[model samples]
Target: MPQAKDHVYLDHNAGAPLRPGARERMVEVLSDVGNASSVHADGRRARARIEAAREQVAGLCKARTRAVTFVSGGTEANMTALTPNWQDQGAPYYLDRLLRGATEHPSVAAGGRFPASMQEVIPVDANGLIRLDILKDMLAGGGPALVSVMAANNETGVISPLAEIGAMVAEAGGFFHVDAVQAAGRMEIDMDAWQADAISLSAHKFGGPQGAGSLVVRSTARVPAPLMLGGGQENWRRAGTENVAAISGIGVAAEAAEKEAQDWARLAALRDRLEAGVREICPAVTIFGEEAPRLANTSCFAAPGISAETALIAFDLERLSLSSGSACSSGKVSVSHVLTAMGAEEATARCALRVSLGWNSTDADIDRFLEVWPQVVDRLNPEARNRAA
Candidate 1:
């Protein structure tokens, strides 16, 4: 096992290491003295910086500059997008309904629960892709509704067919919202091509600062009632003072990510190498979403009879950090919702580990993980290893 000083991060899906330029941008913003909303000269300079950042973020998603509304994080973006928009105040039925994929992140799940009676779950296939047939059926039977589907899953990295889903939602006259936090920097997202009404993204997912995110809403899309009410900011869509430093950092990160699309190919190759090595050394290991297209940097797999908790600890000991599931639910040691949605048994679900790469990943990182993984698994589940051997 490598020493602590040599620890390698393989949990980029949780959050990537901050880019070199992102920190510098944040520091520069912090050193400035001005409110983004102020009309004064200094304030105007800050506002210009904020607008520049907004353009960079919007460019990454291929969205209009006006479409991006900065928020605290992915959770806030999702909540803002999912909140019901009551068009007819006089109608007997107060319009409140949320449609979400079963494999969504906890934030989406929690937001779906906000309107308790209105929450509907969309099922997923064995590859963790949402069932289009099920979605179509729901849309067909729906009243006023909002459908929340992720562009790419965090745990398994399965990319959803958003363009088709968006068309279906548009046909049904229901709002379509996409959680594109994981897909923002990793995959190509063209809002116009997808025809999505709204999409959510987080800067930290793309090597930007934490606490900075955005909700991109099409011009024709109906804006939901604000969840928070206070000082007018975010064009009165979101309240409270903006985090200028974080926003600036996010913009820098977005610009860098957009300019570095070729990095995905390298990360994909490294991910494939890691999966191949795991399968070769540990024959019982099963790679999740192998039959489907996935994010270039992610590889989620399972080793039977070895719990994800044990594997995570073993990996940590070897100076290789990965995840059992979403970083938000790390300490819970629960079965993955993505795996369960994929039809994995509870035992199999509990044994899953997600290893994700990023811009900083190298062939040596993959080799280091390959060298340590088998020993870690053996140490964690000796009886199972012996049986397999």
Candidate 2:
């Protein structure tokens, strides 16, 4: 776990601090004892709470209330969306195979429950945007397919051309699923406008409890089959009893996150300032996706001559929290698959560092970064950095 104190935290892409509204509601629901399936009044209250959360999460995607299905987290939501037709034998579903973005989260890129052969990648450009021409050529001859593209990337914060992608998928008669976990609170996403068939969201990414998430389908009639069969919950779209407190937290957090999205301009300005400061410290620093559309609160740059591992250790010693691309696997920094998809050279990709801001970030945090970051960069020698390069 990332230890946070008086230290500055620039890893909101990993997790945001829990919102007070969510915390309060979670505590209240914690003592309201009953399974959502029972006939008693307590059960009725629990069910109502869960349904209310469904509506709130749906609002974040501008989706129908009936189409939302609660899940464990973003991973389960992505996994569930990919395998909806897994058990429907002898019935022709709308989609026949999965085509995901090369830069998708590992959960979507590598976590599909379908057979490996059924899944393939859609490449991206150097700016981290999906290559539409290549995608069109791939889609033209395939059987009705399922396309998985993220609204915003977790690593470079690159925003995809969703409306255009949706149009292409529609023309090809395929279903479009968006892994929207990173964009939930930072940007507005309307299912109708984006033409997404299914969307996944995580609570912790938007100031809610970490254990809850949602999959909001564009149409209730097209809900995916439950991944497991434990009990009659979520109208059979998902099984197992709901987590009452966590669901309540998601409800309040969603409502709060909607408000948070309104302040993105300010966050984006702050991010730009941070990037400018980084450039002054090291003129050769490269900011990924700098010329493309991206989330307002994210800045990913590689200091010209420093390895990310050395920079991370130096930053930690200075009490500043940052990450090299997305959260590393098992606390070990590995080369980013996202940068790789954008065709980055091995050394450049390995040295990339991501600094993500959030709702609580302020001028002080930026100042701290500007103050200590130069020192961290100045301490590294190019000759010593070459070994890791």
Each candidate's TM vs. the true structure?
Answer: 0.93, 0.94
Off by over 4 Å in 1: 1-5, 86-96, 112-114, 326-330, 382-389
Please report, in order, the local distance difference test score of every candidate based on alpha carbons: 0.82, 0.85
- How well does candidate 1 score on lDDT at residue 189? 80
* lDDT by residue for model 2 (1-389), tens: 74566699888998888988899999999988888898899889998998898888888778888888888899999988886273223343646678899999988987477678888799999999999999998899678788999999999999999999999999998888899999988999888888988899999998899978998888876656678687778877788879889988988889888878767888988998998887776777789998899999999988766889888999988888889975556888898989988888889888899999887888899999999887786687443322332
Global CA lDDT computed for model 1: 0.82
What are the per-residue Cα lDDT tens digits for candidate 1 across 135-227?
899888868668889999899889999889989888887777899999877888888778777889898888998888998876523565666
Weakest lDDT window of 10 consecutive positions for candidate 2: 380-389
Top candidate by lDDT: 2
* Lowest lDDT block of 10, candidate 1: 86-95
In candidate 2, which residue pairs get closer than 3 Å at backbone N, Cα or C atoms, i.e. clash? none
